[model samples]
Target: MPLALNTLKRPGPLSKGGMRITALGGLGEVGRNMTVFEHAGKLMIVDCGVLFPEEHQPGIDVILPDFTSIRDRLDDIECIVLTHGHEDHIGGVPYLLKERADIPVIGSELTLAFITAKLKEHRITPTTIQVEAGDRRSVGPFDLEFVAVNHSIPDGLAVAIRTKAGTVLHTGDFKMDQFPLDDRITDLRAFARLGEEGVDLFMTDSTNAEVPGFTISERDLTPAIDKVFTTSPRRIIVSSFASHVHRIQQVLDAAHANGRKVAFVGRSMVRNMGIARDLGYLNIPKGLVVDFRKIQSMPEHKITLVCTGSQGEPMAALARMANGDHQIRVGEGDTVLLASSLIPGNETAIYGIINKLTDLGANIVHKGNAKVHVSGHASAGELVYCYNIVRPKNVMPVHGESKHLHANAELARRTGVPEDRIMVVADGVTVDLVKGRAKVSGKVEAGLVYVDGQTIGAATEDTLAERRLLSGGGVVTVVALLDPKTNQPVEPLEFLTKGFVHDDRTFAGAEAQVNKALKRAKDDKIDDIGALEEIIVDAVSSTLRRTYRREPVVMAVVVDA
Candidate 1:
């Protein structure tokens, strides 16, 4: 067993001490999820996920959890456990492995295969331990067991972690599906068994807790897709999360039954399909799958293209097709069915694509008034069922926004859990369980980290705010050359503004304000350059706010040459 986590090795003794739980992300909001469980100085992290960018955030695809708190103590990390293969839950694995590639990753066979494919995409593969439902394994001082749970995707699981303090059940993203397509359902009996063993804490998924009823099973999506395939006369296009291999299989079956050949596009869809087929998780008919390069030659009525970009991701195949940037453009007579609902905060981008596709003369189908997309999270009844099965001493809700957390808390209380036993934690807050009671002990430096192109570091809320400001307000720079000989201004101050305004627009008023500030400062003989810089920045900022009601970042350059 590993003694201490490498990510926590150098940090000073924690204030709470003993076994503590820190939610890196997914506490206050949905996505970019990570949770740290530290006991006896041994740390094990679960589900390092990434969040989808909001509408205001242009060009950014994902937001990952900051790992700085755990970076230095990776040596003591026993293992990295995964809940499923969804982007929000598993997207950060590559980034985490890039930092420390030696850490062992444990998950279901399908989950491990998916992670491996993702790692290979980044060219950084790590050691994987595949643990199925009912399998028990020990990592460091923690005893881990995988309990099967049904969700939109196959192989979704809730992890049962037994530590020295007590047994904690980390319910990964899950829904209680009675009529799931797969044979493996959430083993309520097993969860009840754990309850009998006396679980100290239960961390559950709150993504769909606020919804009134139980979520529709993944099988419910088939009839919707089947009707579209059976009725559409032209080529059909279906887009969804690539990790939903079962959904893809259902689409394939529907298309084949309707006498249409299916082609998988987008790099992610192709890669994941390959892995699913290889692992015997997905079975694709020999002639059903074809290269998109040969798509033009096939009859439009006989073709069904299943691609990515259901979230309106910029580089995804569907986005490229909608934007007319793809090699095979979306043309007339194509029936594009948006089988996925737009995630909250991505409505503008998704609608933009919808408009583009419609403008190109393709008929569009959506969930605007019909059941096209189904959530993979449990509702109140399902949550109650899981609670009744687990019956932990304490309840903690993870993997959702504040509203979901509040709902989950209420559900736990209504289900007979004590009011004092339920704890609501925000991101970065650590909860300590001492003698079977849980309370917030302290806070950790946890936030969002943007993994853009090649850079990986902390990109907190402030940074994202700055990005939004820069995009909207633009930037301004003022350069003044102060003559050291006479300590006076040599010439008219050079002012430059890019992205602040249009080419023809005149900022003469703003420029005059800066000049006036510089002249006033020079007359006073203000030798402190830093103070002068601040004054000029304030002047420009205040001017912009008055004129445009906007605040753009101002950089005042004082060069004494």
Candidate 2:
């Protein structure tokens, strides 16, 4: 069972020879994955990433893990260990680097390449140490070992942190795909060796804990993709994550077999693929890939466009095509393949895009209708296998929501790991491992830091609430010019509204009510413009609520004449 939130207290100082673990993000949520490990007065971070904004978080570009707990200890960080190159696993590195740019970053070649390219876009050159699976390094007081893991993207890894206190094996998003396209499998031999070495705390990915059986291999998607290519008569447009190298490779193979030239549409898709190709992770046939501009001249049947926006992001190329706002427009007889899973909270947007594309006379193919995508995380059966193999003293599930965490914890329990040995907790919850025993210690500051445009950490919950009010209830502004001496209106009160009501005349009675309230305030000797403005706001709000049963954003501006 997870630790109770009410019982959580501020973490006390670390005891001698004890190690502290705190997650800044990626608990009870799916993104912004970060965790801080502290031992011997030093810290080592694992996976600093970003969470894409949901519909409720309007105008937000991305949500980052709050760095309040570590902002003061930036110099104490030895390095950041990245597991993969997915946005949810590496997107926030640039923001974190802006605080202190010299921190060393460690990852596989492709992972380093992705972050390096991303950091270059931010105009910050990062100090990176490239290491592959089986490489071990000792930084500060932490002994780190990287193990190969099979995920949606190539060059993924799972890291083992060995220290004087204990050993923690963090399985960054992974699955047991026996027949991966690249012929690389999850290294269970290394995991068994780590288990023999006695892993004290196992932090495993819990994203697919509720799912049953093993995840299907990437090679299994070949037939479905081939079918899509064979049946589609006109232009075929495939959408997927920019970081999914295996998926893109499969699409390339399918397009090649069907004798169609492929063009990558979105800037991110083009850039990331170029990086993957340069790193030898993506194998492209010569003359099979064409420029997007050149595809316009090719026959629709011979052209295949692979782009981003499988999640229905409005600004992505696929969504723009659905909205008829992109140069590569979808029309009759076109086949649109959404080759990605629907991320939670993105169902509405995805369905809306599907509807729009269907209305445009395009045949839609998705996971529901075809086997075009598979998860990158281990399922329940695989988790059980991992637990029985590793046989750790304690377990802490990461990279999932509350139910997923609980489900993963349950799997551990059934695998003979004592129920009390499982620590299921949310973000910021601290755990301490000492003498081979791990338990919840306390909590820290792990709030969502939002990014809006070029500003970071400026968009707060109150700002989102105000935006929701404006978007849902509209806004009503009451401008009152009051006498400087008596706080009486020097001129008739003016009401300006946007998205509040269709007709300004609808507020005629509201004007009378505000005037009466102002007169009463004046008769009561209320000379302060601020006080009078409150009176006007209360009167207007009451009138609107009583008449229309609606509560809009009522603003009163008081001016001294």
Candidate 3:
């Protein structure tokens, strides 16, 4: 169970020969996955990633893991071990590299290629070390071994870190799909071998812990996808994550079988697919894939478009098309396949896109109505199997929300792990392992760092609150030209309102209240512009609350005339 938040305190210095583990993100939530491990005064990080902003976080491009706790210790970091190439698993690497550019980044070949491509966009040339499944390397005091894991994306890995303190096997977002499109399966044999060597703490993905039974194989979707291609009367548009090479491969095959040329839309979809194809992860038949621009000229039944925005990102191709803002128009008889699951917190946006596309006469097919997507994380049955196979002394669930973590902890409990031995922690909660026992140590500063356009960490909670207030209640600006001697209004108070109301006359009561407050200030011989501005703000705020029953952002500007 998770420790009570009120009881958590700052952890003291690490004991000699003990390992400290702290999650900067990816606990109590789904994305921004990062964990810091300390042994022998050296730190090793795994999976620095980003969280997509929710609807409430206006103007935020992405949310990064707070690096404040380790900002001063960047030089002590040995390397960042990445498990996969998904955006949520590797998106924040470039931002972290900006702090220390020379930190060695270790991952599989495809993982390294994806990060390299992403870092190149940020103009930071990273120092990367490529390693694959079954590869072992010693960095600082940590002995790391990578194990192959099947996920939605190709080349996913699970890393086992061994040190004098203990061994921690972290399953980085995996599922036991016996038959994957790439023919790669999770290596349970390696897991059994590691179990024989004694795993002190097993940190596993908790994404699908709430889900019962094993996840269906990716191959099961092939029949459904082929059916979509065969039955669709017009152009077929399939939307999924850019890094989902397996899903894209299936789409390409389906399109080719149906005599339709595929075209990739969106910049990320084009770029990542090109990299995957070049690296032999994605197979494209000759003359099967065509350019998006060229696909426009093809007959509707002979063309297929694959794009991003399965989660309904406003800027992605699918969302733009749904809004009728893109070059590709969604008309009657067009089939739109959202070949991805609805990520939590994105339901409203996705449904909004679906509504828009439906209004445009497009036929929508999603996981809710069809078998177009399957999760990449292991479910309850798989988790139970892994727990029994590894037989770790302790278990800590990672990469999920609060319920998922607890559900995963229960799975461990059912597999004979003591309830007290399971650690369900949140971001910033510290855990220490010594002599093969893991316990919650303390807490640190783990908060959200938002990226807004060119600015990073500049957008704070208060800023988002103000944005929400403005977006919901609107803004009212009151400019008062006051007399220099008496602090009385030299001209009638000018009021400007936005998002609050359509007419300026709605602020007539607020103007009157401001004038009355200014008169009282003048009677008190208050001449300071700052003091008068405060009085004006207070009066307008109170009046708006009384009259309009709304509290908009009230901006008071006082100038001496």
- Tens-place lDDT per residue, model 1, 293-392, is 7865888888899989998888888899998988767878788888775666678889999999999988888888557677888898899988887788
Q: What is each predicted model's overall lDDT from 0 to 1?
A: 0.81, 0.93, 0.93
Worst window of 10 by summed lDDT in candidate 1: 1-10
Clashing pairs in 2: none
Full ranking by TM-score: 3, 2, 1
TM-score of each: 0.90, 0.98, 0.98
- Which is the better candidate, 1 or 3, if ranked by TM-score? 3
Off by over 4 Å in 2: none
lDDT of 3 by residue, 1-561 (tens): 647965899999998999999999999888999999999999999999999999999999999999999999999999999999999889999999999999999999889999999999999999999998999999999999999999999999999999999999999999999999999999999999999999999999999999999999999999999999999999998999999999999999999898999999988899999999999999999999988889899999998999999998888999999989999999999999999998788899999999999999999999988888899889999999999999999999999998899999999999999988999999999999988888998999999999999999999999999999899888888898888776677778888778777465677787777878878887888877888888998998898889878989888998778
lDDT of 2: 0.93
**Candidate 2 per-residue lDDT over residues 26-141, each given as its tens digit:** 99899999999999999999999999888899999889999999999999999999999999999999999999999999999999999999999999999999998999999999
Flag the better candidate by lDDT, 1 or 3. 3
Give the per-residue Cα lDDT of candidate 2 at 140. Answer: 100
